[model samples]
Target: MGRWMKPEVYPLFAAVGVAVGVCCMQLVRNISTNPEVRVNKENRIAGILENFDEGEKYAEHGLRKYVRGRRPEIMPSLNKFFSDPE
Candidate 1:
């Protein structure tokens, strides 16, 4: 097996596996949480022509919930270093 695959290739394989796993997890999460996705048979036809504003609001709320209380800057100390004098 060592002859067929080099040690350096292992990191590449691991990176690819991690990326694929993250993509699959995100796909599942989006399908499960998205309000626009109607999984039920009855609700699909009943609200086929319903307003999309509610769904947009729900998406916005979800985004805000995730970003709540988190700092917007990636590196506050680095940002402060180059700022104008107070």
Candidate 2:
């Protein structure tokens, strides 16, 4: 068989894998540290909290629910509130 199509494609595959891994990692980190995104998330949380009384347990309950892989239904309400209807 010709060398170009041979089974020695390991190095080429590894190079492509490494490049894709680096790009994904950088993208995740960049998004995690974005200030505007963070602010919007905090504002959403605040909006959710508005339905509760002062010093209520809703915040803690939300954290627990989110950690348990549950998305609250109130998310749509918050999104609708924040979204521009224009």
Candidate 3:
């Protein structure tokens, strides 16, 4: 309803949505990386005290693994062109 909605409240709604998304992502990350919360049955049998290293490895296996060894440049070619001696 046009009468019920205010343009000024839109930014607040957007901010709240973003915050909720961030919180959900953090919750998922925490659950996935928690050593005690094993998803696999075999891992559950192995107990919480063990396989901490494996959990750490699992946490690092996605984008983090790929980016870990990469140069921290946004535009490597452009940077190289500027830095190179004529």
Query: If scored against the real structure, what TM-score would every candidate get?
Result: 0.55, 0.36, 0.52
- Local accuracy of candidate 2 as per-residue lDDT tens digits, 32-67: 643333345556575433344433442354557666
Q: Point to the candidate with the largest lDDT.
A: 3
lDDT of 1 by residue, 1-86 (tens): 87749987989899999999999987886777667677888768777556678677756775688889888988888888888567
TM-score of 3: 0.52
Candidate 1 residue-wise lDDT at 44: 81
Candidates in order have lDDT scores of: 0.79, 0.60, 0.82
Highest TM-score model number? 1
Q: By TM-score, how accurate is candidate 1?
A: 0.55
- Lowest lDDT block of 10, candidate 2: 50-59
Model 2 regions lying over 4 Å from their true place: 1-6, 36-86
* lDDT of candidate 1 at residue 41, scale 0 to 100: 89
Give the worst 10-residue stretch by lDDT in candidate 1.
54-63
For candidate 3, the 10 contiguous residues with the lowest summed lDDT are 47-56
Candidate with the larger TM-score of 1 and 3: 1
Please give, for residues 48-74, the per-residue lDDT of candidate 3 as tens digits. 476668777867768898899999999
